[model samples]
Target: MLLATSNHLGHDIRSEKYNVRGTKYRTKHFLEFCIFLFFIYEIEDNLIQNTR
Candidate 1:
């Protein structure tokens, strides 16, 4: 999850540096990252519950 977030942020930074209009792209990437994080959290929660 951290890697995914880092990759998205890196892409956004690269887009900004290249003078590409990045607002939309960044927003999309951020939303994707949030979704991925939520998925990871759910998986972790399930694992913890199963362990107990």
Candidate 2:
């Protein structure tokens, strides 16, 4: 599921950020977080359609 995948990605991002603490890593994680947000939006849309 998207939620599970996002949770896994979040765990990886947190662990990697702590392990490295580099600007490049921070930017990469930021971008990934943006993509995760987009996916959340998509999931919401799907749920709305299902309810309708």
Candidate 3:
């Protein structure tokens, strides 16, 4: 199962960076990506514990 949903966020960032009408503020992507990786790690940990 896919965990990170960065595709839409990535598109938004690109659009904002390129388009004139969108906001150009940046910083959340890295934060969100880290959080997502954390969740994936937690899930994997739980699965490993359950299998033991």
* Best candidate, lDDT: 2
**Residue-wise C-alpha lDDT for candidate 1, range 5-35, written one tens digit per residue:** 9999999899787666567678889999999
When sorted by lDDT, best at the front, the candidate numbers are 2, 1, 3
Give the C-alpha miss distance for residue 22 in model 2, angstroms.
Answer: 1.5
lDDT of 3 by residue, 1-52 (tens): 1335587778878887677433232346667878999999999999999999
TM-score of 1: 0.60
Cα shift from native, residue 29, model 2 (Å): 0.5
Alpha carbon lDDT of residue 42, candidate 2? 100
Per-residue lDDT value at 31 in model 1: 100
Cα shift from native, residue 41, model 1 (Å): 0.2
TM-score of each predicted structure versus truth:
0.60, 0.55, 0.51
lDDT, each prediction: 0.91, 0.94, 0.75
Clashes of each: 0, 0, 0
- Flag regions of model 3 displaced more than 4 Å: 1-25
Q: For candidate 2, which ten residues in a row score worst on lDDT?
A: 17-26
Q: Candidate 1, overall lDDT?
A: 0.91
Model 2 C-alpha lDDT per residue in residues 1-52, reported as the tens digit of each score: 9999999999999988887768778899999999999999999999999999
